[model samples]
Target: MEKVNYKGADLLAHRFEIRVIRHFNNAIEYNAVPFILTEIQKRSDDFFQFPLSNGLLGTTIVDSAVTVTINKNIAYEPRRYFTCAHELCHVLLDTEYIRSHPGIDTEDKNGLPSSKNSSRERRANHFAALVLLPDTILNALMMEKKSKSYIRHQQKVSYETLKYRISDFIQLRFLLSRSMALDIASAFADKDADPLQQKGIYGFWHAAEDENISPLSRQQIAQKNNDLALGLIDPMVFEGCK
Candidate 1:
């Protein structure tokens, strides 16, 4: 099968994330991380997780309802959140892709971005990264800190694996020089962004702290989900989704 345009898949993921933010909650000060689970639950009722003694991080099933199964034994805290987000990518963005290729489980050995990734796997990874760090919040932080180093210090992020990921995000968001992104990567010691920060920074839809999670006022979550779903049905563009 031809590889899907990764840029398109990533953009589609971003669109979905924006809907998640707009639909669930839009307050600036409130945390938006819990919405990951909230959005998952909103999409499907039965969500499940278990410890994979094996090295595998997570998996998702799309039978009557989507169910996310995660590795409970992982050492890193951020890894679990990353795994869940990755599986959600498969659920939200790759539903048709999985349907066409049944039983081909989406597995990851640590969920690191790899040069050897298959097309769908690459898309899912990118989707997870973006959902974990929405550009709007990132932009606000970056603009406020004035230096990526300052943001790193304030957030206490120090993941070696994430240096490259942050570089990718900088490249995607600011369209800055690769050298600048590389410069930003060196400030951190050896850690990823805080998943706790993600929870406090992001939020549950309609969580008490969020002033913006009102239901059915004007923003349309269902409509946006329906629209994004059509684009994802056939992610490989030349095969004719357009």
Candidate 2:
């Protein structure tokens, strides 16, 4: 099965990126999501080590100047950074293609760039995987885990016998809660549903935080999301979702 683009919504996946970059704090750090995003954009040429452009997947034509907006509502900070990177892909790679292949996800043909169901969407997704988990950085991260796993084993990020402790430096600088900061963890662990389906659950969970819900009750949301997806979700593209 294919992963939902989330229109670049899930921020949790970028936890590793945030955690790693924080180690070099004087190099990059931010109190808010937007600042971090802009800093990231500035450092993209250095970190992602990729050339930038406003290309799309033929059908969808998004925009050239991609704006990375930090969602302050989510409880997780890394999730915010992940979202910025995901949108960065669309801005950097999906603008033109979206215009040409516009089809699904179009509320109207008015002015918005259209997309061909999930083609343009899926391609940007592939782009995100390449963006977030580029081979070099991933290897370095894996090594921190003391991972003895070979290339073939690299795919098993979650189950690997190694464990790389989240650096204390990152937690202090980023102001990340330990539970919120660990692992390039996925915000939603739902197995029954795709990322798109689980986004609402994430959004709602964040919303509930501002409400009067008890801490114990909040714990149920994650478990519930997993339960909802357990029978329905199917893994795709990557393993351990990292």
Best by TM-score: 1
lDDT of 1 by residue, 1-242 (tens): 44766776577656766665664343233233466667776765466666665567776666665667777776765566666666776777666666666554457565643323367676777766666655665555533322334433332222533455656754444343576555444332234533332222112111212234235333353343223323322333212211
TM-score per model over all chains: 0.59, 0.32
Writing each residue's lDDT as its tens digit, candidate 2 over 111-200 gives 122444555454444333433443334434433332222321332222211122222212332233454433222323312334542343
Best candidate according to lDDT: 1
As a whole number from 0 to 100, the lDDT of residue 129 in candidate 2 is 48
In model 1, how large is the Cα lDDT of residue 201? 17
Q: Once superposed on the true structure, which residue ranges of model 2 sit more than 4 Å away at CA?
A: 1-36, 39-72, 100-116, 146-242
Q: Which ten residues in a row have the lowest lDDT in candidate 1?
A: 200-209
